[model samples]
Target: MEETMSTRRRQFKADARQLLDRNFRFYLLLFLPIFIIMIVTAVPQWMNGAGVDNPGYNLLSLLSIISGLLTVGVSFVLIDLQRGVAELTEPVSKSFTIFNRGAYLWGAFALEIITSVFTILWSVLLLVPGIIKGLAYSQAIYIYRDYLDQGHKIGFLEAITLSRKMMDGHKWEYFVMQLSFIGWGIACVLIIPIIWVVPYMNQTMANFYVNLAAQEDESDEEPTVVSPVDDADQSTTESKPETPADGDEKTADNDDKTE
Candidate 1:
């Protein structure tokens, strides 16, 4: 009992340490460049069109749409960063270099495009399918992380399935974890606190995943161990033979002699 408690405590410490050590600066770096790019393209157009009917205002709106599309793609980058931080939090930390920003960005773009089309088509019905698709696709960053290192060979559908599976039973935990950082995110409205906080939260979440992943591995390994009864069965099978033992042979000989 004491040993079990100590092991749990050690696991908690390791998880906490993993979260604390995630490289906040890297995520901040990723968030800023994309943010700056979006702002450069977006704010100017937004500011320039304060009036109701400027001819260029239509153009500005188009630009805004385009910027929004790109921003959607940027989510893939966020996902990649988040997953990277999470993978680092394992009992044994894996080294993470910055991920391929370009591929993730484009993948995000393509996904957004396809989903957008589906959403529009499904607009005839209620919005439930669209919402589910959005959540399903939300894991692209994790998908990219698993695939990018291996030369992009994994089937896209398979990656999606795996991410969804990883998220199973943990979706609520994930939602709460994201909510934990919402306060910091609100602070970013005034300044760039998100640069630090976003990465921090992402890494913290990554740590959570690591802990959960470890628990899952442990659970899987546990059932494989044989119980004492099973061990006894094996012992009996190994030691006893089906062929006539001395008592059985003597009985048979007596029966044969009698016959």
Candidate 2:
């Protein structure tokens, strides 16, 4: 039976929860640096809330960029961990390994900028369309990673286009999947809970991508079809008996005469 979108979403979350239950401590440690980066970035914005010109704003902006780039790494790590390809022992190093590859580091940065601009542009027209576009492009980073895996480097625009294609019928399901995390989002207001919630949400999103990619791959494959005429021909060829040679016929005739 074909699984419904709701069923798949539930399964993704369930799998993520099960994985987390087994390795919550490790996952938390993995995501702790990102949480700290986010908190540090937010501090300047909070300080600037009064509209006063804060000198730290420039530094905060730099930190924000760093955070965003590191987030791409974190996403890669979580996705790898979800797919069972990443080691659990060196979570921090694995997360930073994105920086080791210039192509991935820059490609991820470019993709982030492109997707954000496009989403913001759509949002400028209306809130719903922007939200929908955001959901549609949510898988751009994952798609980029896939391209890297296949040794086919693609531009940020192309990656976004592929993500939009991959997400054609899944925007609502993805939206709802994110919406279901409202409770966790609320709990993160306490600050410390963010370490737990961040990894959980990232892992669940990774599961979502894994399932969606598998479905897309299945759909892309063409099934082999056998024609009835061809089947009949093959069956006849297999069932037909071999004709006897002249020697055999002569021997049979001789045997009959002798009998």
Candidate 3:
């Protein structure tokens, strides 16, 4: 039986929690540098008050963009961890794996720019549309990773386009899945809890992508359909021929009648 979206969402979170429970310390260690990086980039902006009029706002914005780009790497790390493909012994080194590959680095940069521009454009119309569009594009990085895995060198826009398609009929579900982490988000306000919360949230999100991809794979499968003509042809091919005994009996009966 096919699972409903809500059921899958719940399962994704539950599975994530189970995985985290086993490797909570490892994930916490892995997320430490990322949290620190975010704090380093954000603190100055927060202190200075980010605004158009501020002189350092542009610099801070650049830092923020860089930080966001780094998250592309973090996403891969969490995904690898979730999928059990990563080396658990070296979480810190594995976290920077995206930077070692030119494809991942540039692809992430392009995706970030393109999606941000599109989301900002949508926001021009209204806040809700922008949020919705952001949700639609949420899977772009994961889709891009999939394309790379399949050896397809797709452009960033292509990944975003595929994400929009992949997210069809599931944007609200994704949003709700995100909202399910509201308690974790609230806990992060204490700062110390952010290390654990960020990793937990990211792992759950990775699980969400896993579930979404599984559904897409299932949906892409073409069910075998038997046509009436084909079935009839098959039946005719399987029909039994007359046995030698039956042919001999018919000949003997004819001969007997003649006699």
Tell me the whole-model lDDT of each prediction, alpha carbons only.
0.44, 0.69, 0.66
- Which of the numbered candidates is closest to the native, going by highest lDDT? 2
Name the 10 consecutive residues with the lowest summed lDDT in model 1.
Answer: 250-259
lDDT for model 3 comes to 0.66
User: What is the TM-score ranking, best to worst?
Assistant: 2, 3, 1
Clashes per model (N, Cα, C within 3 A):
1, 0, 0
Number of the top TM-score candidate: 2
Q: Compared to the true structure, candidate 1 yields what TM-score?
A: 0.48
Residue 141 of candidate 1: its Cα lDDT?
44
Segments in model 1 whose C-alpha atoms lie over 4 Å from true places = 1-30, 45-49, 52-108, 112-125, 190-192, 201-259
Model 3 lDDT per residue over 108-154, tens place = 88887778887888788878767877887888877777657544456
The window of 10 residues in a row where model 3 has the poorest summed lDDT is 250-259
Ranking by lDDT: 2, 3, 1
Query: Cα lDDT of model 2 overall?
Result: 0.69
Better of 1 and 2 by TM-score: 2
**What lDDT tens digits, residue by residue, belong to model 2 across residues 1-259?**
1258678878888888898888887787677777788888776677778675678867877877877777778777777676666767876676675697888888888888777887788777877666777787788877777666544546666666667667877777888889989988998886546767777788889888877776665564320111222233433222211223433311212111110
Error of 3 at 191 (Å): 9.3
